[model samples]
Target: MKILPYHPSVLAQAQLVDLINYCQNTEAHLAIKMAEQADIFAIPQVYQQSGGNFWIAQDAQQIVGCIALLPLDAHTGVLKKFFTYPPYRGQPVRLGAQLFDQLLNFAQQHDFTRLVLDTPAAETRSHTFYEHHGFRRITPNELAVAYSYPDRHSWLYELQL
Candidate 1:
């Protein structure tokens, strides 16, 4: 698999939506929510335009995963759209770990001191992943004003880079 940064087809890639849909379906009845589903159609504007980036994990010809980094302010960034096609998630594949490394490298290189993210409480695997990477659970009040989360009720995690 290869991790590629910045693709114009992000908005046109059906697999991107398919991957997101796959994740949602796993916890379809949960309280997980998005501020605006249409935001996917404006990735560059919502993310990159704010001095952040989006990445895709492609396996040969297929898109296996994706993640977005959105700057909350000069020193903070929030992760978004982090998803991995189930079959490539763990073990020898380690696609999620690789994607996470990319995000961390980017965060550090960009001089971001802290990284924040929200995961659906139902996604225990994701919670474990974040914690393993040094993220600690934090309250919403601990977040900055620029931090606007789509998941109204999510487990918040923050890592000080």
Candidate 2:
């Protein structure tokens, strides 16, 4: 498996869509409406336009995992699109951990003072993963006002760099 920075291209965007939809719909059982969003198709541009980055983990030619870092401000970043294909999740290969570590390194290099993320409240496993990696839970109301999209049931987490 190889972890690489995402390159802006039609093909790369398509792979990201497939990976995200597969994880959200098939694995998480989230409603189709939850997976439909314009940002899914413009990952590189959305991230790059804001001085951030997107990354993918691939095995052979297939994308198995992805993560994005979006700059909320000079000192803060928002984590998004963190997912791992079913076959690569919870295995000895540790794909999620690798991607997360890479994200931390990138945030540090960019001099971000804090990183925040919002995940579905029902995703208990994800909560544990974040907590184990030093992320602390925060109430949605406690999140920055710029992070206005988090729903009432969203689980918010933050890591201080």
Candidate 3:
């Protein structure tokens, strides 16, 4: 598999949409309200507006995973849209780790002092993953007040770089 930064082109955007919507509908079983506001379809624009970046992992030219780093301020960023296809989640595949490592590297290169993310409270696997990667759970109030997208039940995690 190969990891690449997202391009703001029709093909790239379409593939991103496909990967995210598939994950939300199948794996996440997210409520329609959550899925709709997840904003998977406007990735390029969202990243562009936030002065951030989106990345994708591909296997044989098929998008299998994705992650985004959105700038919340000069010293902080918010990790978003992190997902790996089911078949690639664990063991030898490890697509999620690869994507996460890349995002961390990018954050360091960009001089971000901290990285924050919100995940659904029930995604225990994801919580474990984040914790293993040096993220610590933080109260919702600890998150920047400007980040209002995540619901009240979402668990927040932060990594201090």
- True-structure RMSD, every candidate: 2.2, 1.7, 2.1
Q: Give the range of the ten consecutive residues with the poorest summed lDDT in model 3.
A: 31-40
How do the residues 19-130 of candidate 3 rate in per-residue lDDT, one tens digit apiece? 7777766677765344465556666677746777888898897888999998888888899889787899999988999998898898898899999998888888999999
In order of appearance, the predictions have TM-scores of 0.90, 0.92, 0.89
lDDT of 2 by residue, 1-161 (tens): 99998876777778878888888788788765544566666766788678888889989988889998999889889988899986787768889999998888999999999999988888888999999999999976677748655473788899999
Going through the candidates in the order shown, the clash numbers are 0, 0, 0
Report RMSD for candidate 3: 2.1
- For 1-161, candidate 1 gives per-residue lDDT tens digits of 78987566744367777777778765345523343566677777888788889888988867889998998889999988888988887898989999999988999999999999988787788988899889999988887646666674689999998
Better of 1 and 2 by TM-score: 2
lDDT of candidate 1 at residue 14, scale 0 to 100? 74
* Highest TM-score model number: 2
For model 3, which pairs clash? none
Compute the lDDT of residue 20 as modeled in candidate 3: 71
The CA lDDT of each predicted structure is 0.82, 0.84, 0.82
What is the C-alpha local distance difference test score of candidate 3?
A: 0.82
What's the CA error at residue 11 for candidate 2, in Å? 3.0
